[model samples]
Target: MSWVTLNDMRTWLVAGALAFALIALFAPRIDLTRDAYDVLAVIDITTSMNTRDEASGAETVSRLRAAKTALREMLAKLPCGSHLGLGFFTERRTFLLFDPIEVCENFAAIDEAIAQLDWRMAWEGDSYVSRGLYSAIEVAKSLDADLIFITDGHELPPLPFSGLPPFDGKPGDVGGLIVGIGSRTPTPLLKYDEEGREIGTYAAQEVPQENRSGAPPPDASTRPGYHPKWAPFGNAVVDNSEHMAVVREAYLKQLASVTGLSYAYFGQREDLLEPLVAAAHARPLKVASDIRALPGSLALILLVFLYGLGAVAAGRALIRSSLNLPPPKGAK
Candidate 1:
């Protein structure tokens, strides 16, 4: 019972090992976050999105570039265990570039995919905004994921008759938000060649000639009687024309309303993600049990060593006690 001894040290070591063994055997429960739903992110990569208006610090960047930056920030904030998929709107279709995967695990690939998005990926020179949005809804439904549609909401021929697009999906089919990106004042869109090399900005009178035949291009002539409103073909440049791309906030809001979703500006990353957090909390989480085994293994090894030493020491003490022999050096 002296201050401290070899036996005391041995006792403490054995007790510590026993505690670790118990912890490992029981597999302490930890609360691991499980996402209630997956998110399908649809990005618009049209030529008009090349308008350099979105501000980043002191420099103005293209809408597409700003969108990619915002996406990177959003991806970094995605909830743990949440699943995310990337797609792009091109040629009036939502093309799934990749399927839903764990966001945390595959963030690098997601970032790469986001960065690679550009007008060059567009199969055609048409941005049927409404049609692309409809396609996004279908894609989201097929994936059974919540939708996050990011776009400038710039329609090539402006919504025909100024009406909302057809959305048959019932409300609550999926929860999501339409994130609008752009400025109110239009900016000249940077033109690019087929190879995606930047040429120059489209001037007011530089009408996008859809073959100069008063007929929609082959790729954009899919819908019957759907001749896109061709920019007036003439050298009389309308100097006052607001040809620059704008955010189209009203159109985006209307689309969100038609689809039973929310709308938000993409200027602030946190403001956009707040609604996502609410959407995530509203769904039912699918839990996955994770039983870690390493700690238990290490504890067991220490326990074995400690127990062996304790046993040998106990056995020797017992023999000496039985014979009533003199104490060994350091015996208490």
Candidate 2:
């Protein structure tokens, strides 16, 4: 009501603001339950992934490299409490390099591991993509983590006319996404030496032109040179575009359908994030949440309001002095 009382109240308000700010500065995070993800991602390191179908600035990059880049970006976007594991798919199997670990804590190690994935890691030259996807699902199941399988979807020793082998496991048991990596346009599949030196592109005859996994064509018995014992499929060079690598989107989609997984293409930097997050099932996790900022911001706003009030009071005092008005009752 009086100037003295108003001044005292203002001083108390300033002190209260400072106290709240100090508390905010020293406040510790509280434990809270929140939803987080646990993902085990397997990358296809087969030879077909060496195809340079993605562009980076003025340079073209291999599908594997582009996948790694997208993964690194995704790693940064994952929530702090979420977990991520890495693995390499080759030789009809997915080999788990490490179990799922907290993403934020082991970010550097996870990033370095992804960067080091190479086609030479394959022990065998065969790329059975369907089998590899199944293996990845098993690995994820063992760890109780969601699966993220990144591949160009190029199957070596092509699928037989009978189609992919039956998946024994129940579909949708382990949920996640199958990320297709590569362009639709066919590109020459690059060949490399054991030492990891790029030699040249594979010729059509160099790769399997037709499915060899099942019994030879039904008409094999009637063929001219068909030998049931030795050349059941007939030793003929089939002219097909098998050597050219492309993203088998349709095949990958079929695989996704059979496995109860979602499908996404790795094109732009942000392409993988949305599908990945959508595929992830939220698991409750205890997280240490820092709430100090809330009170700190409130304190800051209060201080600003107090400053405005002081400025108005000073302006009033100045105006009154210039007008030569007498001091108000109980004024200091």
Candidate 3:
């Protein structure tokens, strides 16, 4: 009776394992309802983004490098059905490199495109952050996709005293995330030659010290050497802070408020996805997910377990025989 029962148990285990193995061999797929995203990601390629304020392991990396790394990780995390587009911000405009494409199908092309992004691609030196963001929104709207604008919020030549140029688009017209990428502490902006060789940092005198596009400062008349025609703000005092780069979180938050977009600090690669996904408009997709490995792995585990059980039982029987002990009441 014991022998028959043991054989029956072994047969059942073998049969179950074989059944799962066959199912795995068929490699069936299932259609799942998943939220898919259509996103246009625009990166800041301004000179200020060259500021090395982020630490990667023991070595420090530039803001642009950090942003690219975070973006690469984001690409991998996006699901198969999701679509992604690429663009770069420079000279007060966002230039779209490509329209949205399916992530899984065109991952290599998308990653290669991102890897090729360079500060040298800037058509102009000025970084009009607000205008660039507005352009990004327009591009995203044209593509019917959400926007992911990554920048340190550094405005080259500085913004006008009148505040950001009026946003032509209505708030909440396009949902997206504004990812601020840099440290709070200011660091000198690195200057690079035409060939992309870093020479030195921008001097305080070389960059704009204040807003010169709008109305003069309220105290402009009281400033030293204040000449309405020549020295508007002042000729004696110049703020050098504009020459340095830092993550303007407050400014970015204000931009987010005006645009009806969510804000996120790109401190770590993992921190970007949540706010990004939350801001993205989800479109339901029928995703065909292959589940072959699930049953195949289970089948393998079952077979290994059955083999171990047989080995243990055989060893126990051998020990009983060696001791010349009775097989007990149910023994074969």
TM-score leader: 3
* Candidate 3: residue pairs that collide: none
TM-score, per-candidate, Cα-based: 0.67, 0.85, 0.90
Q: Model 1: per-residue lDDT, tens digit, 276-311? A: 666532445555554657667777777788778889
TM-score-better candidate, 1 vs 3:
3
What is the C-alpha RMSD, rounded to one decimal, of candidate 2?
Answer: 3.8
Candidate 2, overall lDDT? 0.89
Question: Candidate 3 regions off by >4 Å?
Answer: 1-8, 18-29, 227-234, 269-271, 291-302
Predicted candidate 3: what Cα RMSD to the true structure?
A: 2.7
lDDT of each: 0.74, 0.89, 0.89
- Which 10 consecutive positions of candidate 1 have the poorest summed lDDT? 231-240
lDDT per residue (tens digit) for residues 129-247 in model 3: 99999999999999999999999999887887778788999899999999999989888888878788989998888888887766887888998889998878777768759988889
lDDT score, candidate 2, position 324: 100
